[model samples]
Each structure stands twice: as C-alpha cells, then as structure tokens.
Target: MGSLRINKVKYNGDKYYFESPVFTENVILIEGDNGTGKTTFCNLIYYGLGGRVKEFLKEEARTHKEIVNDTNNYVDLYISINTENYHLRRFIGDNDITVSPFTISDVEPPTPNEIETNLVNLDGVELLPVNRSFGNRIFSDWVLEKLNISVIELYQGYSTFKVNFTELFRLIYHDQQPNPELIYKQIDTKSNYISDSELLRKAIFEQLIGKSSSEYYDAIVEAKKAEKEKLLAKHFLDEFEPIIAHLRGAEKVINKPFLMTELEQKEMQLEKLHYSREAFKNNRTANTTIDIALDDSKSIIISDEIGLSESKEKLLSLFDEKSKLFFLKENTAKEITQVIKVIHAHDQLNLFSADTCPYCLTKVERVSGHCVCGAEIDEQQYERFFYTSQEYKEILKSKTKTVSTIELAIKGCEEDITSVNSDIEQLTNNIQNAKKKLRSILDSIDQPIDIETLNNIDDKILSIREQISLLNQKIELENKYEKLSSEYEVKRKAHQSAELIMQGLEVKAKQEIVTKVNDFSDVYNLLMTETLEDCRSARISLDTYLPVINDGEYKEASSGVSIRLMYYLTLLTLSLEDENVPFPHFLLIDTPETAGIELSNLKNCLDKFSNLQSISNDYQVIITTGLSKYPESLANNRVIYLPNKANALLKTKSQSQPL
Candidate 1:
C-alpha cells in the first residue's frame, strides 16, 4: 500500500558529475546501446539505496574502471516515500549510506537542482550500515520501515531470520543475469544469512501480498516463548521429583499443619518427661526440709545469670563506642592533613611576583591597604577568604588535641570492658557452684527410678523431636512442588491459546494470499499469451508463486526471458490494481533484452509495460533497453538516450559528450 518514487539520481565524481532529468512520468525509459552504462545506471540506483555493490563493481571493472578508480565517486538518489521526500547517498565501495530528509523552503517536493544545492545543509541525516551481524542496525530494516512494511521473522532450520529488503528487492529488480530459470536472484547461501529455499520464497511472496504481518509474527514469537517457559517448568519438576519423593517418605506427612501438630505433641511429651523425672527424685528424697535451701540456691543462680547477661551487654556497648571513636579520630586526622596541604599550596602561590595581578595578567597598584581592583585588602578578611598557613596549623593542633581526648576515652572504655569481663567470669563461677550444690542435694536422696529407664525416655523424646523437624522440612518441599505444578499448568494453557490464535491468523492469511494470487495469475496469463510466440497457457503455481507456462515448470518453458518479464510486469500490474498489496509500486528492470528474445515479443512486453500507467499513475518502472529495440510509438517514455559507448550514462571529464 506504500508508494516509493525515485525523482532523480545524481552521480558525482572527483572530476565529473552526471544528473538524471527529473522523473515526472510513471514509465521512464533508459534507451541506450550495448556497453553504454545502462546497467550501471540501474546499479547506481540500487547502490544509492544501500544495496551491495562490491560484486557488481568487480564484474564491471573493465567497462567502468574510471568511475571505480575515482575515490570520491558516489551516487545520490532523491526519492519520495508516501509523499515524504528523502535523499539517499552512498559512495562507491562503501558499506553504508547516508539518508537525509529532502526539504527546501516550503517546497512539498524539491526539484533535483534544489536538492543538489541544499542537500549538504539539511539536517536529520542518518548513516545506515549494511551487514548481517547480529544486534546491528541494518539498512534494509530502515528501508522497510519507510515503506510502511513490517519486518517479520521467518523460521529457517532451527533459527529464525527476518526478510531483508534486499531479498524483497530481488523480486522487484529484474536483472540481465542469464539464469532466467531462477525465479529470484541466485542467493549465495554461504555468505548470505538467509538460504534460498521454498520457505524463504513463500515468505517473500506472502509479505509482498500483505500476508505476513507483524501481528502474526508477534503471536508466533509469543507462543514459542510460552512453550519454552512451560518446558522449563516441567524440567524443573522432573529433576526435583525424586527429592520430593524422598522427603515424603522420611516425613510421613504431606501438610504444614500436620507437622505443626506433631511438633507440639513432641514438645509436650518432652516437658512431661522432665516433670516426671523431677517428681520421682523429689518423692525419693522426701525433700520438704531441703526445699528452702534448694529455693535459695536456685535464686542465687538466677541472680548470677542476670548479672552475667548485664555485664556482657555492657562490654559489647563499650566495644562499639571505642570502635566509633577510632573511626571518627581517623577521619579527623585525614581532614587536618588535607587542610595543611591546601595551606602549603596557598603559601607557594604567594611566592609569585606581586606587581601584576595573577587573574587579569595586568599591573597591580596598591593605595594604602586597598588592591588595584579597589577591594580593601584587610589581612583578617583575606584569611577568611583563603586558608592561611598559621590558621591551618592551629586547626591541625586542635585536631591533635581532639585525637588525644579520644585516645583517653578509648582507654577508659577498654578499662571498663576489662572490669565487666571480670564481673562476668565471677558471676559465671558462682552460678556453676550453685548448680553443683543443688545437684548434690538431690543426689544425696535415694533413687526412685533406675538410670537406664530415664535414658530410654530421653532417647525416645529425641527421636520424636527429630521426626517433627523432618516433617516440617517435607511440608515446605511439598508446598513448593504444588506451586510449581500450578505454574506449569498456567504456562501450558497460555502456550496452547497462543498457538490457536497463530493458526487462525495463518488460515486467514492463506485465504488472502489465494485471492491475490488468483488476481496475479489473471494478469500474468494475459501477458504471457500476448507476449509469447507459442504460449498455450501460463499460471502462477499456488504453492511456489512461480510461473508455470504451457503445463510445464518455469525451467521447462521455451522462453525463460519472456516468462521472467511477464512475471515482473504481473506483479507491477497487481500492485497498481490492488491497494492491499504491500508492493512499493516501484520496479527496476536492467537491460531486459539481453537474453535474445524475438524483437516482436520484446516490443509486446514494452507495450504491456507502458500500459501500466492506464491502471494507475502512482507507480514508477525504470527499464533499460537498446534504442533500436524499443518501438517508436512509445518514444515519449524515453527519458534518457545513449547513442553509443562514447556518451554513456556515466562520463569522465576527458569525454566531451553528455548522456
């Protein structure tokens, strides 16, 4: 639906320059003889738009060595995309192109002369690099964006590749290469990132007809991402399934509440065991008389323990205060050193000549105590403005005094810490002694239960506690497994939904392509019948989008050149007729008469090409052919005429003629 029209093409070199006449017609013809740079003109247009020209220049070196050797040679293509003017410039043997917006004082579309004079002063120019490196801004993507076409990714093998503008232009540009059996240009698969396969060809065709939209590709990408996430979740679950099973077997519980209940029960059992052991000792001792002594010993232990805790806390507080004082003292010392250095720098500056002002480099005069600038030079005020050496010394002395004070404080704090440590040690010994006395008082009584029975109870209690801890751990793992399972299900459903939406879009796109292809075939068959000598029938294959002539494949056709020409014309005609087709409404056919077609059939093809203007005047087709081969009736379409190789499309300063 987008429109691209080349208004002018200018070729500049160190010693010569050539500019094409402003293209004001839909069908522009470049009629030139052999070896007259007709193909060079076409290649310049391609190169100016950021197409590769290294291989092209290498092949044409013998014929166009002068233009190649001129290091300052570059081509500028002035074009309008959807009524917005732009200028694209690319030098020979360069991998990048400079694109600038073409604007001239209130002109909707500036003339080529205005562009040439004002292009250098224009703003918003961008340099687009052409390469296949990942994460780089590519030139083709910019062209596609300007053409209002969405770049979509196509799956190739295990990787995905977006269709570049070069790939799309191959279908639009019908070169003079002899391999007419190939529908598209022969892609060098080794160097090219995208392979020349059925998938690519179909994708190109689908894009041209507006089938492969960005929305469709977005859905596909989302579906793939969701599927990947779902698989990751499943993998995690599979890897941890054994661990979950092991936890379940060890805990014998599935939930947190059950584990909590078991833990509480074990704790209660432990408390009961302690109480029973104490009661049994108490009953054996009949210790009502010693109860008071026991109470006093317990009180003493409690009091000593509290005192020990308080002393430890005090020691920690003193240590913290000492650490803070050390940090503050170190920082203050650094500040004093920095101030002294500043004072020394200021003293050094005073050694400079005092007759001239350092800032203004002018003579200085003092009247009384005032400076040359009429500012009072009070010594006390000057000291306030800048740090004086004596003042800095005083500051350093003060900082030293403060450091001494902090040292005293730290010493005091260390003494207090040592005192607290002594208190803590004494309190700990007193508590231990109290506990020993209480134990002896109990041991003096007769034993109510044997030691082996108490040991058995303690072992059972420890086993129950261990079981409770294991149950808690298992409960946490089970909860995690449940959460992961829920996540997996959600991802799986999302992926499935995305897949369905993608499939639906695919079906709708296929239907649209089918309708467009049928329309394309109508024009193609008509052109083939009129242009071919013995053409029985011609139709584009639905699957491959290639022409099939006389019930045979493209390669099987008797005249491949005729089929190729008709194929290009058919696309042009379809684009003009259908507004939905995403073609740029532009075609570049370079020397189509190379493959030796009959003169009558060639003229028929030319007539079909000129007839496109009747459908719509919104398209531009630039075709190169020999002057003698073109019919005389369509002479108005001839925009450029090259008499011979002497007046080629590109000429050097030594040459006197013009194109």
Candidate 2:
C-alpha cells in the first residue's frame, strides 16, 4: 500500500495559498533554482502526508528567539489519492498541536475516517512514525517498506558514501555542514533523555559485581593491572628485603664486644699471662732492691725482696706498667741488678734460690742467673761492658714493646666485627618485611574467589548469554511459526465471517494487492536502463533486500531520494496494468532535482518514474525539483513560483527580536 497523498494545500490567516500539483506516475519533476523556497514547499507537502509538520512548527515556535518570529495562525491540506476516494482534511490553527483537529472526508475513493488520537488500522499496519524531520521517516522507514524488505539488513549491508549529516542535509536541500553523529542512522536512534551506554553498564556492574560484558572486561583489566603493579612492587621488595633482613639479624653479633676476633681474644689471653707473671714476680724470693746512696757513685743494696715495703710498693703501684717494657737487666749486677728488673714485665730469675737457670743449665745460680749468663762476674769485669749492657737493655725493651703493641692492636679489631653483625641483623629484619609484602601482593593477584563465588558469576554470564542466544534463535524460528499461525488464524476467522476470502466473516470493501501490474519485461527494461550491469526484474521479491554490488554488499533503502523513488515506483508498478490497489495511486513528491544527484542518473531514474503515469486517467504522478523539466505528455502539470523578492542566494533572514 502507498502512503496517503495530498492534492491541494491551504492555510488560514496567511498572505497567499501555496499550491503545487500532486504527482502520481513512474516519473514526475518539480523544478526551481537554489534558495527558491524549494525546501519549504517540500516540507509543506510532507506535512500534508500525515507527517508531524505543525508539531515541528510548534517546537520551533517555542525557541528563545521565536518571540520575534511570525506565528502560524491556521493551516489546512486537502488530500487526493484516489479520484473516487476520500479527501483528508488536516487543520493546525491551534498553537498547541496536542489539540489540533484533523479529519478524513469521503470524496471518491472510500469511506471517511473521523476518529482521533492517531488514525491507523489494526494488525500493526499503519503510517510510519518519523524520528527526525525527513531523514527518519521518508528515508529510513518509507524506503524499506517500498522495497518490501527490512531496514536493518539494508543498512548493515550499505556500501556507498557514508551517511553523515553534511551529506544528508545536502541531499535534501543544500545548506551548511551538518554534524557527523547527528546524521541519524538506525543505530543512532535515541530518545531525548538518553543515558550513556558505558555509564549505565558501570552502574550496573557496581551493583551486580561482574555480570555484563563491559563489567567483565573492565573488572578483569582493572584487577590484572592493579594486581600486576602490586606484584611488581612486591617482587622488587622480595629480592632486596631478604638480604636486608638477614644483615639486620646478624648485626647483633657484630654491634659491640662480642669480641670474637682471634686477635682480640689473643690480646685478652696475653693480659692474663702478664698478670700471672706479675704474681710470680711478687711472690718470688729475690734479691730485693733497697738502694741508699752513700758516697760518690756507690749504693748499698739489700736484695731478697719479693713484695716490697709499704712505701716502696706504693711507689711501684703508682708507676704505669707500660714503662716496664723499656727497662732491662744491667751489667752492674750487684749495683743495678737489684733495681734493673723493677720496671720490667717479667722475672724469669728465681730470687734467693741456688737453682739452675730455666733457659741455660748453670749450677747454684743466684743473682747471676737473672742475667743471660751464669758466671759470677766482678763489677770491674762488667764495667767496660756498660755501654754494651745499655744497648743490650734497649734491645730487650724493644722486644717486649713489640709484643705489648701487638696485643693492644688486636683489641681494636673486636669493635669492627660488632658493626658487621649489626648490618646482618638489619638485613634480616628487611627480609621479613619483604616476605609480608609478597604475600599481600599474591593475594590481590589471584583474587581468591571461592568455588561458590566463581560459580555465581559463571551462572549469571551464562544465563544472560543464553538468553541473548535463545532470543536470536527464536527470531529465526519465529518466521515459520508466525506463517503457520497467520494461516491458521485466517482459516479460523473464516468460520466467524461468512463472506471473508480467507477467515473473517465481516463484509468489507473488496480489496486486492496487485504486486506487479506492469509487464515484467517492461519494468525490467526501464530499471536496467539506469545500470551498467545487465538487469533483472526490478519488482522486489518478497524476500529481496534491494540492489547490491555482490552477494554481500547491499544498497541502503534509508536514503532521502532513493527511498522516495522506491516507494513511488513500488505503488506505480503495482497498479500500472489494471490500476487496482489498496492505497492511493497518485504521488506528490517535493523538489528533489537539486539534491546534488548525477544529472544522467536522475534523468534515467526520472524516465523510469514517468512510465508509472499510465496514459489513462487512472494513475497520476507529480514531483518537485530545483531543475525544471516538463515532460511531453505531462504539460498540464502546474508550476509554483515562490516570491524571489531579493537576492536568490541569501538565507532567510530573521527579524530582530524585541527586548
């Protein structure tokens, strides 16, 4: 069935009546130059064809700048689709379109419909609703219906210039550049109050905790990234911290006087040896030194002193023992022997004892044993050797000094060992800390969900995926089931309506759908003239999805001009032979001549278009174009001239607004 047509259009409280002839043929043309009110006239005709024109005007009227705009007082359109049929009368005087009046009056075709609130027959067959002004209905929906196919398949398989807004606007009427996304497509169909897809999914994911596709991907990615970073930090810590902790723990043994070094231990041992030697010296019965100078250079000596008198012991104790390393036995045996070893560290001699020497075997040795030799040498015998004795004492002092220095130096080594131990302890503590970090990182990575928890997410995703899958399958299965159901319903209704052709019993107007009224060869010939490839039948099969380049690349039916043409030709060819169809045979097309289409293709298309206007008075076709052309057989078609008061290329200037 074809769309309802409008024959004549008029308005109340207006300066003039804008008139244009209705087109009902295979080809019709409406011509004018650019900026000549062609778009306005197109809108007018579209408005008369059950489009929401007055409503669009009302919306435009409420704009903030509309205060200074001219108001539409009243509007009306007379529709003539069939000569013996009805005329549709539509009125839009009221400022509010919600209460605007529209009625259908019988003229020549059939009965009139007066009901309100959107007029349509049952069974879901009705005038298509427009989303935007032109691109929505005239292009997307109407074209698909004319081609006798679904719109979704046609759009998915589209292979041509992409349908952005600029191209779309240029197609209808050359204007400014249009926004890319704003050019509507089936996928972009949306309501005024629309929510973002990602945002909606985010909120749902937050509440549901991982069910949707986006949620699954987002959660997985987030967890993986977070877990990976955490693990990376922990992995670094794990490598360094153990060594640090180990050092920290081992530092205890190194910090202070654990004094475990061999050198330090040996020094302590030497100290003990010194103390023992001193004790032996203190208890030994030796020639004690009690010197009192009498004359010139001589002194009396009483030796057999082990521990000295109180005054002498006090004097000895007051001296620093380190000086003992510098003293030595002298050659003045009886003279200096009593005091030679006084400041020294060791007394290998046995005092007041007639014993053999510990190192050399000399019998009955006394004070002489304290010397390196065992002979009782006279003072004069040793007198010449004084300088040598002095040198000899220096050598003994240097030897003992070297041993004490070694012991003292070894004492310092203990402290360094303590510091190394402290370092080990710190390292040990660090290691422990690192282990803790590693554990936490591991936990976060795997996200340890119990089997039950995992099962829940799995079940939900499976359920949703299954639902989508089943819905798809059911859609495929629905065709067969629906066909059977419809056939069954038609047969079942026959019992109710006795005169019905298939099922229903109600007595209604005789109806018929002449799918293709023209000769198949003629229609093919007309359609093929516009193509390079050999053409087949142009009448679309019930299952066909329009022209395609290959088996895959399909032509879009949602095109402003193509759709209009598709729709017009569909009805024209269907009613061409006998001229009997359910809907109007006449078509009123607005100016499409200036849509920047190829001149040859448009003419070829128009040629096929003109063929629909069967020479008889049964069918009529009228079209508007910016390029003027009056066909030979259709000279009687009316011409509309909008007042070109000034520059033809200028945009419609707006009047200044009042404050």
Candidate 3:
C-alpha cells in the first residue's frame, strides 16, 4: 500500500487566515489544551486526504458554518503519498475539489492575495468534483487510483459487496469523537444492513491479513442465491400440481352456453330419427309378394283390418299424451300428501286443553267466550272456517280424484301402446315371411338396405370421433404438466449443490483468518505499557475483533482509551512489517493521554509511537493531545502547538494575524 503523510495545512479567504507547521517526523504529535482547534486541525487533514468525515462529523460541520471566515474561504492540504507531493484544496463551504503538484511557490500563499476569475483555476491543478449520487465515489476513486490500491470485493447478503479507500480511512483515522462501545469499523455510513456485524468483522480482518478471496466468497453467494430460486420454483410446482391435474382432465366446454344450442339441435334430430324408424317399420308391412305366381290362383284377400301405419301413428300420439298424464299424476300425489299433513296438524291444534289459550298462557271460563287478555275463548272455533278438516278433506279428495284420473289415462295409453307394439311384432313377422317368399320368387333379383340404417351408423361414428378428440386433448395437457415438473426438480438439485460448495469455502476461510488474528493480538499486548502487564495477555475477540483482556473486553477496562491505542498502534505496526496485512501505513489518532493513567504508563504509550521505527522502516503516526498531559519525552515529537482556542490552527475574523 502507498504511504500517506500530511505535511502542512493552509486556510485563507475572507477575514480568516492561518498556517500549520510542516509535518516532518514520522511520528508527529499536535499538542494543545482542550478547545484549542486541536481536533479541528486533525479533522482538516483527515478531510483533505479524502477521508470520510460526514458520518462522524456532519453535525459539527453543520453547527460551525463559520469554520472559515467566509463562505468562499478555502483550505489547502500539502501532502505526500509514496514520496510524490500534492496539494489538495477545497472550498470551506462549497463542493469544489482541486489537487495540484507541489511547487516551491505553493509552499505558502502570497502576502497580497491574487483575485481569481473562477472559484479556482484548473490550469495546473486537477479539479475533482464530489459526486454525491455515487457515494462521493469520484474523490475516493481518484485517491485510490493514485495510491495504486485495488478495489476490494466481498460477499454481503446476496450481492457482491464493494469497499473503496474512503471506507478504509474510517479504520485508519481515529477521530476525537468518543465511542466506547465501538472500537473497530465505527463508521457505519455504508450499506451495513445486509451483513452480520460479527461475520463482517472477521471478514475485514481476513482482508487485511491477505486471507480474503473475492472469487471464493462470490461463488458461495451465487450458489446460495441459486438455491433460493430453485426452492421457490419447486414450491410453486408443489402448490399448483393439483390445479394442473384438474385443468388437464377438465371438460372446458361443459359449462359453455354456446354448446346448449348444439344440444337442442341434437335432441330434435334424435326425435326425427325415431319418427322415421317407426314410419319405416310401418312401410315394411306392405305385401310385396302379390306378384308371386301360385299353382291354385285365388284372388288375394284385401281385408281392411286396422292399417299398420295408422295404428302406429295412433300409438305414437297416445305415448306422447301418456307422458303428460304421468307428470300430472306425480304432481297431484305431492299435493295430496301436503293437504293430508295440514289436516293432521289442524286436528292436533283442536285438541289443545279446553280452558286455556296456548300463546298467552291465560286462564279462560269454558263458556265465557273470552280470555283475560281479550283473546277469544275457544279461538280455534273461530279460525276453524279457514283451516277446517272438511275443507282439507275436500281438497284431498279432489287431488286424489285427479291423481286417479291421470293414472287411468296413463294406464289406458300404456295399454294402447302395448297393443300397438304387439301388432307391430306381428307385422314384422308377416314382413319377414313375405320377404322370404319374395326372395324365393325373385331369387335372381338384387336388394338394398334401408337409408335410415345407414344414416344411424354414420351418426354413431361421428359421436365416437368427438369423444376420441376430447381424450387426446386431455392427454396432451398431462404431458405438458409432467415436463414442467421434471425441469423444476433438475434445477432445484443444482442449486442445492452450489449452496454446499459456498458453505465449505466460508468455513475454510474462517479457519485461516483466526490464526493470523491470534498472532497480531500477541504483538498488541507487547506494545502496551507495563501497567497492563497482568492483562497484556489479552487477545482480539474472535467475535467482535475488539481487544479482549484477561477474558474480559478491553472496552470495559479502566484504561479503555489506552488499550484502544495499543490495539490501533499494533495493527498499524503489523501492517508495515507483514506483507500479509494491507494498510495505508498511516495513522491519525486524536488523543491517548486523556485517559486517566499513571505518568510512567502514559510515557510508555508515547514511547510505543517512537519505538515503531525498529519494527517497520516506513509509516506515519499522527496524534493530537494537550501539552500538559503527555510526558516530556514527546516534546521532540510535538509538531504543532496551539496555546488557546483564540490562536488555534483556524483563526476567525476576530483574531489578528502575525505580520
């Protein structure tokens, strides 16, 4: 990773102007008492380096609109990343971003300022705009590109998650804001809802230690996604299987009103066919054997008995009339039953106890003809005319008579139909005999079958064909449903396999990362002061990635701030020496001495910063603190000193500037 070192910061415009001393040493401390713009100065360097400050410092920026003297005021940061110097400039109250290469003339602003045609000239400096819609990604992208840092990718939820250098700055720059509960990944401004906090903490640790593999995690996530889709598709099939089966065999035309017209036409045609069959049977009775020659010739008898055609017609008409009588007989029987029930109920009502009214439950004199409630005594007697047994008996008798008459009429019609049938049988026998004789007389003659028989055979064939067509349609639908079901099952199993592979990779990756974290925790303990010697055996919590001292969390310890410094410094120190750990090789810790600690322990903490050169040859550590708090040993490391808030790094319009 490319190393970043902030050299100096300059603010000029309107009525405010101030300049910070050049940062030369590897470990530079900005010392000042409280409210002396110490925090503000550190934050300016953080913001100038494209470090994300909105999440933790948005409220501070909003409250202090006069951070500069005027809205058009500007702050410039002269910094070096990987030995290349650059000046990053920004309008205090605007969205303008500009960067230029370092020049001798750029060391400081001129005494008499020169007016600009636009906000700032882009002749030499590169103008970088903050693209808010894309997460202000443009500025971070440019910084990372210059540093030669590749974009990192990891799996979060169902998507491939991404993080740029701007996010990494949150981990590197420890601001003045105190958050005892959180020690790592405090800035949650990104999409944090999708991943587990514990799992992501481990994942970040893995990434820094060079144990993370984007391809491996992404494959696992993709497989999980496929599995979910397959499961959904399978469930869809299971839910609709019954419906599909019903649809396959369903007779879609059964309830159609349009089919009713066709049914009526078929009924009429069937009736006509029946009439034609009867006519044909009657016509077959004709004597066609008269032409046969006989040995004793006698006049053929022409007796006039009832003609087969007329008898058949009379039988057919009687059958039609009998059907009506049968319906009337059934109707009359129902009416008779209803009337009988009514009469029985009336008789039961008439037998109610003599001197009491059932509805009012009141007593009555047998001969008084009235109840106490004004209800008529013997009320049944007055209502007898409406539902009298005699009237009921009359209606029953009338219905019974009508039923009997209809039955007799139906029986008479049935008798006539039976007699006609017997005569038709006889006529059929006579025709068969006549046909035999005619065949004998015309032994060499050819004969044809009846037209009605041929037409009946054709109609039967058409009906059978229609049934076959319906059966074929049902079979087609069944095949279609089966094919769909098979495809769903195949895809479901494929998704399951992918999910298994993803889970295996995750388990393997976790094992490798835990080993490295244990090693780093040991180094962290060594860097702590002797005061924490008893608890120096503390390790990074595998779950939270925070320091765990003596089986207890470091955040809960009395020297939480000091422990945090050990954790941050150790991580930064490891990043410089170990090729496995990826870090910016830069640190901006606000205050470590503010925590109540012994003077010797405080010196040990400051010495840790000074002692980093032995472990790593390259790194920058910047810390802000009060002058009176830190040990005298750090006096040589003090890069900037602010006596009070009035003469802080950022001079307001009211403060006077030195000549």
TM-score of every candidate relative to the true structure: 0.63, 0.32, 0.52
Native-to-model Cα distance after best TM-score fit, residue 114 in candidate 2, in Å = 26
Off by over 4 Å in 3: 51-62, 93-96, 100-137, 145-150, 153-161, 179-181, 188-196, 211-508, 529-536, 553-557, 652-659
The global C-alpha lDDT for each of the candidates, from Candidate 1 onward, is: 0.74, 0.35, 0.62
Candidate 2 per-residue C-alpha lDDT over 1-659 given as tens digits, one digit per residue, 9 for 90 to 100: 33334444433222233333433333334455665655555544444343443323535543312112333223334543332222222223221111111222421222213223233222221222333353444323443244222222101122211122211112122211122111111122222222223233122212111112222333333444344455554455456545544544544322122322433554455455545433332221222221111111121111112222333444343342323422321122223332333211111112211344445435453464244355666645544433322233445446545656644543443443354445545544554554554443333342323545445545555555554454444343344344544544554444333323222211111111112222332453355434323333243222222222223334332223433354345434544444323223454555544334455544555556555544444554556554444344443443443334232211222322110
Clashing pairs in 3: none
TM-score of 1: 0.63
Candidate 1 — which residues are off by over 4 angstroms?
13-17, 54-64, 105-123, 188-194, 212-222, 242-249, 252-487, 553-558, 653-657
Candidate 2, 520: how far from true, in Å?
Answer: 7.5
Task: Score residue 644 of candidate 2 by CA lDDT.
Answer: 48
**Winner of 1 and 2 under TM-score:** 1
Q: What local lDDT does model 3 show for residue 322?
A: 84
Write the residue-wise lDDT of candidate 1 on 1-659 in tens digits: 78888888887776666778888888889999888888888878877776665444756534457676675567878888887887776667766666667554332343435645654332355557776576587788888888878777776556777677887887888887767767776552334355576877777777887644445766677777787899998998888788887756654444657666767887788788767655545335465667887899999999998898898899889889989988988998787666545433332233223344657645566565665567778745543554433445467568768889988988898889889889988998999999999997778465555557667767777886787676667667867887888888998899899899989887878777788888888888999988886887898999889888888844333377788888888888888888878889999988777556778777777788778767998999988998777766678888899988768777666665454
Using lDDT as the measure, name the better of candidate 1 and candidate 2: 1
Best by lDDT: 1
The candidate with the higher lDDT, 2 or 3, is 3
